[model samples]
Target chain A: MVLSQKLHEAFKGTVERITSHRTVSAFKEKGVLSVTEFIIAGDNLVSKCPTWSWESGEPSKRKPYLPAEKQFLITRNVPCLRRAASVEEEYEAAGGEVLLDNEDNDGWLATHGKPRETKEDEEDNLPSMDSLEIGKKNSIQSIPSYFGGEEDEDIPDMAEYEEPDNLIETDPATLQSTYLVAHEPDDDNILRTRTYDVSITYDKYYQTPRVWLTGYDESRMLLRPELVLEDVSQDHARKTVTIEDHPHLPGKHASVHPCRHGAVMKKIIDVLMSRGVEPEVDKYLFLFLKFVASVIPTIEYDYTMDFDLGSSSR
Target chain B: MADASEKKPILQFAPFQSVVDEGFWHRLSSLKLNKLGIDDSPVPISGFYAPCSHAQVSNHLTLLSESLPTEASEQAACTSSVSLGNRNKCSVPGTIYNTNTLEGYHALDKQSLLKAEAKKIWDDIHSGKALEDSAALSRFLIISFADLKKWNFYYWFAFPALVLEPAATLVGIKPASQWLSPEEAEYLSAACREWRNSNLTADVPFFLVSIASDSSATIRHLKDWEACKGNGHKLLFGFYDPCHLPHNPGWPLRNYLTLIFIKWNIRRIHFLCYRENRGFADMGLSLVGEALISVPEVWKDLNSVPNAVGWEYNMGKKGSKCVNLAKAMDPTKLAIAAA
Candidate 1:
């Protein structure tokens, strides 16, 4: 496709290429366009125009002509260093013309292909990379996911998880003082507090919670279904168990809550959400949206995350 | 958001019916179980067994022993139980995998062995190997002794399948709730089709081929089904009416499911109502179609039963009664009713 001068000027100074691959050049004029190499420093980094191409190869079948306009170097936004660079690049590349990682501001829609909204306006639009795309060399992955929004929400309906009352070492005074203690464990707090040492935040779509459930969610890479709170519903007695279909689940059928899965999910969501450990599980949770006949479609997914709540691996 | 109310779940604590171990156990006691087409003796046949061949039968048991798993081998070795006069030779080891009977049946090698046994069995009528001891029994035994042996074997397997997984086990309640197996379903379907075309009912009266214990409950349930014999062939795995209980444990859930199903599925149905009120209450159960409230005496008689009709309210179960099946269905399905 031929790029008009106006388009060229638009990308002139911003585009940067770290590795010289002629194939990745933003503009292809008989496939020989220049590739640019760029590595930006911090959060203040913005997309500038692609002005030059970095050269580094013997052009052949094994080695290709370097594209000057395509090379762009950026920094890591995750917990570690060099890995964050790769994640940010992947997020940007994955978003491409139609940003899958786009944040909601008037529910940002891509017109024709390119992003309609500016990246600056959408604060929740953090370039988050998924777990599968994590390159072997880039192990320093980002823990911060969209679920735990970088910006605060309007009226956070998100339930703030508190350690269950039983897990906490409250003096008798506290117990006597409040009748409405949320989590009162049945057994001693010792083992009660010693959970599986992991937390997970799942978007509405990623539910069947393959962890500790009858089946697996094939779409996700997180195969070992976690016995996190969401897969189980907490009862008034502070005991959390796998909630089953009302007609079948034998003992106590939770079917009365037709949205029992969602409701139970909400309780687990309340916990990891309080802390900002939201992992990006948007793809899994989003599919379930159609089944939720009633929830308004306008509610933009909280960029916070789809499923990110990971924990200190024991 | 339009309203905060949309978030709450519409249904709460859906009505659930639980069959405690005691309830199912006591109820299943009266069921012949064989009525479900389950085999009593699940024999693992292998060798030259005729429908009446003693040598082949003995070889089969020897194989049954030889293939037993280590644990089971020791158990069988200790008891050393014997049958078909080969008791001493029945000490062959066995494994869990030894029971695959299909290979032996299909093997060309065994067909000759079976034909030989069949030939010898056709020659002798009083050899004592003939099961059921009848002249025509050869026809029954000849068709597929292997299948009969296997079915009988499974029928016998039910003894353990019934006991080892006693109704007390959480899974056993399934047999109580759903006594019909896929096999039984096939039998009923075939039987119905066959009867639809023939005059089998007139040749033999539609009296139940059902068997029950001499236990009081079994006798009472058998009598209830017999009274309902009416003018057609109806088979029922009989259990006493709940009212027959000494303490009258309200209405029995199993019989309630059973009686209602029979009325709805089988033609020419007429079941004697034990407790008019309880029966009416059962009619309220959706699994069972509506009871003929058309009979005013049935309703009037129900007046005598305690906690009968309106009893579902005390127990948190939905009125899935045949009369209320509509209420039991999704509103969407109700909108488009079928013919």
Candidate 2:
């Protein structure tokens, strides 16, 4: 038994080394991104998605290899309106429709089901509001369904979203500001929900973007690790999502373990290639975020907008 | 007037929960080893908190790596800039009294230290310094003995809140959405959002909300209280509440209440417990309440500092908290554990 265990360990090391090599040089062949590609993808993501900005984090904790000002990509205060289980329940109630490539993974990648209904398909099926009276409510409610269908298309900048009525003229000393008011829900469902500060750091060991989540409860209080786990998909909650010291930030955050990130990403790339869509390294974060969305289905970060070009949605 | 049953309940507040990040401990350990050798002087640190965003969770006064003084001559420079427009992290000035030994920590007069800190807050309120920089009203202190060798830390945090004799009575409290009309809620929400988004007022925890006769609301800094008065508009003393309890405000409000009572001499004050959801003002989570304070004779004296009580509860008990970061922080221990 000991000998078998040793053999298994040695085999695992060999596989890891081989995978690492492939990830290092073959960003096009394999889905994994190199350090430079990660930065390039990050810059593109930040430039495209105003919500996703570069953060230097703590000066001492900043990775020496990475750029000083751009150690990681962070998008703070992303509202998680519902728990993953609730979203899953909604899907199951809607109809137990399976949309992911692999059925064996259970409902892990079931998040794709909603975004799978392409923006064009949604526009074709759902009628636009004929009345401006319902425009604001409809626009806010349909934020999740709104996805950028093309890579080149600009993601709707939620940060800059301002209602004319909500705009206030400030004193000349301060700049004009518009606040996004969290409106009371039309439905009786509790408007209070958790928010997550989602950040992505390039994991050198895994050669993939590592996603970290710092969740706050409806009252803006920090969620403990166990509390954060409730939002994570059951398939990955304990297995992959472990609370670790954030590389840049001061506190421990729930990070999706990147050990199998390369393998899973490679599978996704292969599936994309089979669909005759040539995925590029610059769009790696988009695809990476899509996979991460599978793990955390409720964090409404700015990832849903950019993945429509290279991947086949249901 | 009604009978004795009509008396309103005394207003209580949820105390601030101190959450020291592991990175804070790591930095403290480094500072203890490298810079602060045998010197156990009070090191000025910063604490960060935002208005409560969750309905059931109280936002912690978190100490991060940035909280500590970056340089060796940190003694001269404790008061840091509070103009950081990061809506999520409003800076609270704090000082850490690190003791050389556990005995020294225990023997330290907790009452005197707490009293001295409360005096500073009292002085700030009276001297009008807190009006200019509202973060001064939320000053905090920590007494710690960092066991560098074992990587263990024994610490107790105190957010000194000045008490008001005959504690403020709650007249009525409810969700802002319930209290304000639809138009009023919408207007107030927008006004609050603008205030939070601005670089100058984002970190200012306390402010005045002036609602015009036309249902439009404008948020002004506390320093502009005189300017905001007698404008023939409704006024609310608004603060960034760190508490999520439906009924009570946070610890910051205790001192804030004292400040209000002393500064403005307002007896019945309508206050806004400004909470947010997803970085925007949520009227459902935000609370609008009225606090009626019966000023004590002692408060009449400008030189007097009222008694305070704000020791943070540790593990649901009234005590100090200890952290054992040796497993995670010690390099030798980490290597050995790895081996």
What are the lDDT scores of the predictions, listed in order?
0.21, 0.71
RMSD of 1: 32.5
Q: Go through the candidates in order and give each one's DockQ.
A: 0.01, 0.06
Please give, for every candidate in the order listed, the TM-score of chain B alone compared with the true chain B. Answer: 0.16, 0.94
* Candidate 2 local distance difference test against the native: 0.71
Number of clashing residue pairs, candidate 2: 8
lDDT of 1 at A114: 35
The top-ranked prediction according to lDDT is 2
Task: Give the lowest summed-lDDT range of ten residues in model 1 chain A.
Answer: A190-199
CA error at residue A124 for candidate 2, angstroms? 43
Query: Over the stretch B1-339, how does candidate 2's per-residue lDDT look in tens digits?
Result: 223236887777766777665667777877887888899878888898888765544567887767887655543232233225656678899999999987797777777788889999999999999999999999999998887766557778888878777777788899999988899999999998788767677778999999998889999989988889999999998989877767666677788888888888888888899998645788998888888888766786878778776666543334555555555656885565344
List, residue by residue over A123-160, the lDDT tens digit for candidate 1.
23433223223322111111111112232222122123
Task: Provide the lDDT at A182 for model 2.
Answer: 30
Candidate 1, TM-score vs. the true structure?
0.17
- Candidate 1 segments exceeding 4 Å error: A1-314, B1-103, B108-339
TM-score, one value per model = 0.17, 0.68
